[model samples]
Each structure stands twice: as structure tokens, then as C-alpha cells.
Target: MSEREVLELLRENARYGTDDIARITGLDEDDVEATIAALEEAGVVRGYQAVVDWDELEDERVRAVVELNVTLDRETGYADIASRLARFPEVTALRLVSGDYDFDMEVEGDSIREVSRFVSEKVAPVPEITQTVTHYVMTAYKENGIEFGDGDEDDRLSYSP
Candidate 1:
């Protein structure tokens, strides 16, 4: 429970030092440090990353969500294909998901043409991949449980069914 609480705090802000975490969680500073170390060793805490609002940057990379349907290989399976896809520097994230597609992929490039080329040249050529539908990310309002942009005023309408 304590570990979960610590993780939640870290998720909110990865920059939280031991003293801050200890203060927030009401745990001793030394214990907080030890717990974090243990979590990292256990791979419970994979990595700390800064969530940047790429739209704010003048030179932002083009992003897209690609839905891919695949025919799974008997011997190799998902692990091998997923590994192959992940090696590409353009691939931001990939997941084997349930629904219309076998894989949900996030990729980035300098332009839409670059991403298209990657799909045509790199991804589609794989024997297992049958079809791919790409959806370009126009804007990211929220990600990783954190809302993007400054204004917090709720714009959602309330209704009863």
C-alpha cells in the first residue's frame, strides 16, 4: 500500500526527491529513498520521463496513431514482431491490443510523408502485418493522466440519460 502511494506521488511528478516524497507520504526520508531504490531494482518503476507538450515547440515532430492488423507467426508470435517494430527510432510506443487491430502504434517523424514512408517501406513489408490504418494526432489535450494546456476550466456538458 505504501509502495502504491509512493508510486502515485512519483507518477504525479518524477522530480520529487526523497525528502519531498517522505514529507508527502509521511514516511521517513531514508525509508523513502530505500523504497524507491527497491522499486527501481524490481522494475516496478521502469523509468522517469518528462511529459512535454510538443505542440508548444515550434519544431514539433509529426505524430500518428497506426492501427495494424497482423497474422501471427506460429513459432515467433507477438514478442518477435513487437521487438522488430520497437527497434525503429521513429516508433514512439506500441501495444498489442484487443479490438479492430492487433497492434496500436504511435510513431513520430519530421513530416507526414516521413511517417507514411515508414509505414509503406518499414512496417508493411513485414509478412505478418496484413493491414494498417493511420490516424494522425492533431493535438494532445491530455496524456499520462495529466491534462495539457494552461486553462483548466471544464468545457464538458452534463446530461442525464
Candidate 2:
């Protein structure tokens, strides 16, 4: 298959195995593997990720993003502050960015109060975290652009673009 065909396959679903891609594209398994490897090396295929349905989980968990305004102390390193927060399983993703907030944290908890406690007891106490402004997600309109696909009954079941 052509490079365009390979890219379309990869874009549709990066998680597809080489054998599956070979089946779809009519290319040999080794060729498919080489193409995928080349794309990854070129940074086109960055990484693989799982999309979980949080609502289906047994625990009642609420997702939230906490914007932290921090003052990195000379004594405490940024990694050290991040390490402290990471100890709690609730904190999911942490990133330091340039903006009003020093760190953006994605976390989950059973309730608002539980999240509050996590922020107060677990997060705020960290040496660098001087302030935190939280915004709780009331509802997610859509996640990852997966909007139930087209409602049209006639659409083919081919892989997504």
C-alpha cells in the first residue's frame, strides 16, 4: 500500500496490530511493522493510550482539573513537589505549564468533599503549592471527540478517520 494508505490506517487506530493492518491494507506483516515503526520514529505515532469509561467504574469518582499557583522554594524541587502529589493514587496527570497556574493536575475522587480533602490535606500542604483554584467538571459534553459516531443507519462500519 501507499504511504497515504498506511497513514490513514494508523490515524484510524494506532492500536491495530501489524497483522490486522496487513489484512486491511493487503501488505505483508513485516512491511506493516516497518511502516508503523518509521511513523513512530518520525514522531507521527507518538504513543498508545486507553480510553476508559469512567462512569462504568464501581467507585463513584468525579474528574477534576486543579490549577495550582506555586512558588517553587529553593529547598524543595519541582520534581519533589510532584512526587509528593503522585503518592496519592487520585492524582492522574500532572503537568507544569506557563500561564496563570504553575501546575495543571487531573484528579478523580468519590465526591466533592473527597476531592476537597485531597486538595487540602494531600495537595496544598506540598511546599511549592502556594495556591490552588479548582474547577469541577459538571458534565462532559464529549470526550476525545467520540460523539457516538454518525446516527445515519446506512453508514459503513469501516474504521474511523
Candidate 3:
């Protein structure tokens, strides 16, 4: 199997061992192991993480998407600003985008107040940041291509007035 196939299989299920991947992809177990090791060494595969449903847990957590409009510096531009934003522990994802906003940031905290504080005290205070609009996530039906709750509904109850 091609390297792309191996990568795809791993992406679908990170827990797949060399033997399992080799068996499924029709590649030798040694080759599969070597390919994975090479991918890791070359930085093609960065890291593995489990997708957790934080909402289901007892701990209270809040997630917010903050859109930022910024004045880009002539010398370094958005990279410098984006790198600075990425250093914050609360920031899960950060991207420089086109159109209305210059940057999009995803932040998580223990509470709504904590998220608000991050925007006010940390993000908003940056010199390059001109404007910010924060939107808090209410309910997550799907995340990272995985459906959060039960499968699609099949039947609906009807009532006559």
C-alpha cells in the first residue's frame, strides 16, 4: 500500500498497531512499522490525542470562538501575532484567515467568566488587535467529523389539535 493509504488508515483510527495496519492495508508488518517511524521522524505525523467529550463530564468547561481584526505590522505581519497568541494555554486553535477577520481563535476555559477574562485580559490587550467578537459554543452536535450524541432520528410523534 501507498504511504497515503497508511496515513489515511492511521487518521481514521490512531490506535491501529503496525500489525493491524499491515493486515488491513496488505503491507508487510515490518514495512508498516518502518513507515510509521519514518513519518514520526520526518514530522509528517505530529502527535496523537484522544477526542474527549468535555460536556459529558461533571467538570464545567466553556469553549469560545474569538474573531479578531488586527492591524498587520509591515515587517513581520500576522505570523508574529499568531505565534504570540498560540502560546496561551487557553488557546486550542489559531488561524490567520481572509475576508472580514484577520485571525480566528478557539479558546477553552473552566467557565464563561474565565473565557471572558481571557478575551479581556489577554487577547484584547494585544497591540495589533483592533477588534474582537467572541462567540461561546452552546451545544455540539458534531466535532472533528464525529457525531456527539445518538444517531439520526427515524420517527417523529404526531399530535392533532
Counting clashing residue pairs in each candidate, in order, gives 0, 0, 0
Give candidate 2's total backbone clashes. Answer: 0
Expressed as tens digits, the lDDT of each residue in 1-161 for candidate 2 is: 45678878766676788888889889999988888788889998777676656555686668889998877767877788777787789998888888787889988888989898888888888767789888887755546544433344867767777
CA lDDT, every model vs. true structure: 0.91, 0.79, 0.90
| Model 2 segments more than 4 A misplaced | 1-15, 23-27, 31-49, 53-59, 148-161
- Preferred candidate (TM-score higher): 1 or 2: 1
Candidate 3, residues 103-159, lDDT tens digits: the string is 999999999999999999999999999999999998887776678887778676676
**Clashing pairs for predicted structure model 3, backbone only:** none
CA RMSD, predictions in order? 5.8, 5.5, 6.2
How good is model 1 by TM-score?
0.90
TM per prediction: 0.90, 0.66, 0.89
- Candidate order by decreasing lDDT: 1, 3, 2
Candidate 1 CA-lDDT value? 0.91
Which residue pairs show collisions in model 2?
none
